[model samples]
Target: MEPPELRRAVAAGRVAASELGLQVDDVVVVHNSDRVALRLVPCDVLARVAPVGHLADSEFEVEVARRLNAVDAPVAELDPRVEPRVFLRDAFAISLWTYYEPAESEIAPTDCADAFLRLHAALRHIDLEAPHFTDRVAVALGEVNDRERSPDLPESDRELLSGTLSGLSATISTEHDRDQLLHGEPHPGNLLNTRRGLLFVDLATCCRGPIEFDLAHAPEEVGDHYKGADPVLIHRCRALNWAMFSAWRWRRADQMPDRDRWRATGLDNVRAALDRCHLD
Candidate 1:
């Protein structure tokens, strides 16, 4: 949909601007995206709306934002007023999460460790059970489909993906004891540093699953393949997600020669790290 139609719908009503303290002339369309922010207009107070896509649980983001507001995690300190809202369209989940104020990246290990402990505790309490391959699997697989067209992806690249899929599939029947909601994608960028210290912003990826998902995804150190704030596991996950993310992005646009190759490299790196963890 073009921005005009969506923006028009969002502007057609009197939304409760009290949260944003918008003056009558203040910008009502403070944000715009294919996601469900359009329905946040005054016209639809009961339901929030965003673009139609994966993981649009109309209620999840708001619930997550509320919990994040209450939790004392480091990522919580730097997030914007996260008032996520849910909406339904054509039987699709649509939600919106506000982007916090932009600032420099001044994150530290203290914040990572502190946020990790707090989030782990939260996941321990929440209920997260599942019956099928998670949405991420869908997204990851979707990327694999799009990548098939590239003329240069090596056989090994395809093999690595085969391994990733197989590993993920094997876990489908393997259940864990402790279960709770988790941010399947937890990285440094999801957190911010601000007056509050560290604030977590993204919750669209939250799902019911093993608490170890967060623990495994959490930033930690490895004697090897080290760089930035993310530890080895997080680094590996980052590479995989990036390959998937890049594939998705590339599919949206044109193709890149280096893309398929780099994606393969990322997959190999991720698998190596996971091997170190004995999870792959």
Candidate 2:
């Protein structure tokens, strides 16, 4: 959505909240991407608006958080007073959540790993249907090869991405680790060290996969801290994730401030992953 349209949607969200008896004295834009986050003040609530088709994943995230909270899991809590339902208006889907303020210091990788382990355990109890982790891998590869999606992607890099994705998929399919519910991306960026301690947010990527898949985005220290983690599987997952992320960067390079820098770094990571896989 464009700036004017997003501002309109944010206004619509505030009005929608008012209808539900939630008073919004102010509205602050927290983040914007595929979705827009508005921090509704006085009530201290968050309103997230996304396109219609995208609501399902956001709804799933809310339900998963509800279940995890029941188990005393350390995750971003939803506003329980309001029914967690996706509201549709003007082609946008909105959901309300309790706002969280992070501490001054960033959350350490060790904290992220510890919180992820707890969150993962609680998520296993959620019996909802979720996409497999590899499903995203396929999607990323698709974007890399799609001319309209990645019009600037070089032919040589496209071939390299395709080949690397196939090899990674093969390795993932043969891994011996037990599959379970995963936080999907447990990197430090997705975690917050709040007054309540470390809380995992952005459950939209929650999926069913080997625990190593969740650890792939985390720092090496995080992988080391996680007990019973399969080192070899973690390494393989890292290689796979790097390839996928590299494709993602390439696909969205146009929107980045430093496209050349990002493209260079992404391609470098892709090459590194390919080299590591060959060594193995």
lDDT measured at residue 242 in model 2 versus the true structure, 0 to 100: 75
Which candidate number would show the highest TM-score if scored against the true structure?
Answer: 2
Clashes of each: 21, 0
Evaluate residue 179 in candidate 2 and report its C-alpha lDDT on the 0 to 100 scale. 75
TM-score of 2: 0.90
Tens-digit per-residue lDDT, 22-43, candidate 2 = 9988999887766788999899
Model 2: clashing residue pairs? Answer: none
Q: lDDT by residue for model 1 over 97-172, one digit each (tens)?
A: 4334455665556656666656656655544443232456666656555556533445566555646654543453
| Shift of residue 120 alpha carbon in model 2, Å | 1.7
Query: Relative to the unseen true structure, what is the C-alpha lDDT of residue 81 in candidate 1, on a scale of 0 to 100?
Result: 35
Give the per-residue Cα lDDT of candidate 1 at 204: 59
